[model samples]
Target: MPAPTEITVHQQSRVLEIAFDDGTRFRIPFELMRIYSPSAEVKGHGPGQEVLQTGKRDVLITALEPIGHYAVRPEFSDGHASGLFSWDYLHKLGSQQDALWRDYEARLAAAGKGRDDAMPGKAGGSCHSH
Candidate 1:
């Protein structure tokens, strides 16, 4: 896998721009990242137990921290910071964004949900304390 040469978080555009050593670059949207987060909170522990994320259309990356030389941890405005996105995973996300979006839409439709709908029974609170 090609290593990332540059990574920039565009707050205004809500996208993470990454450039790889192989001259490949991608601008992945924040919404996509949050919905597709590879965390147990979102992905669940077992197959067919995935939690669908909603009301994340305007999710923001509050902070981005690197983990050694392999991955990055992002703190989102919604208090989600468990997912560590590796270079390979980010590259795959960038490359397959369109298909991912289609799958997301299909899941939402099958569940009779909308992108902006809030998750039911979710109590409003911070996942972390300051």
Candidate 2:
């Protein structure tokens, strides 16, 4: 995996930009990053245990902390600071943003949910039990 050579946080536009050693540049919206966060709160601890994240349409990246040389931990405005975005994950996010977004929308629909209907930076808390 290509490690990030440069990382920038655009607070004004609420985006995180990263340039990889392989020359790939990614500009990811903070909202997207928040929803896709690798934290156990979002991704869970194992396969099939993934949780659907919601209400993060207005989330912000309050800070980015470097974790050694392998990853970055982003502090969200909502106080979610657990996700550690590794280089490979970040690259995948940049490259597959559209697909991931579509999947998210589909999941929401299947769950009888809507992004606009969710409260700010919330998760599956509002989802009804099947």
Candidate 3:
């Protein structure tokens, strides 16, 4: 997988602009990142246990801490900071943004919820599976 050559957080645009060593560049929205976080709190332990994220339209990356050379841990303004975005995963997310956004919208519609809707009850518990 191509590693990231650059990663810039555009706070005003609410997007993360990433460029890879392979010459591919992507501007992934912050909303998309939060909803598709690879954390266990979002992905769950196994199939059918995934948690749907909501009200993340304005989520911000408070911090981006590098986990060695392979991944980066993002601390979102919504208090979620568990997902460690690996180089490969980030590449995938950037490459699949459009399809992923469509899927997210479809899931929200299926659940009768909106992107700005607050999650029902409290958020899910933390897990190290990320």
- lDDT (Cα, 0-100) at 87 in candidate 1: 95
Worst 10 residues of 3 by lDDT: 121-130
Candidate 3, superposed: residue stretches over 4 Å from native: 123-130
Best by lDDT: 1
TM-score of each: 0.92, 0.86, 0.92
User: By lDDT, is 1 or 2 better?
Assistant: 1
lDDT of the candidates, in the order given:
0.93, 0.84, 0.89
**What ordering of candidates by lDDT runs from best to worst?**
1, 3, 2
- Candidate 1 lDDT for residue 61: 100
lDDT for 89 (candidate 3): 89
Segments in model 2 whose C-alpha atoms lie over 4 Å from true places: 119-130
Pairs of residues at least 3 apart in sequence or in different chains that clash in candidate 1: none
Q: On residues 12-88, what C-alpha lDDT tens digit does candidate 2 reach at each position?
A: 88889999989899899888898889987777667766677777877888889999888899999988899999888
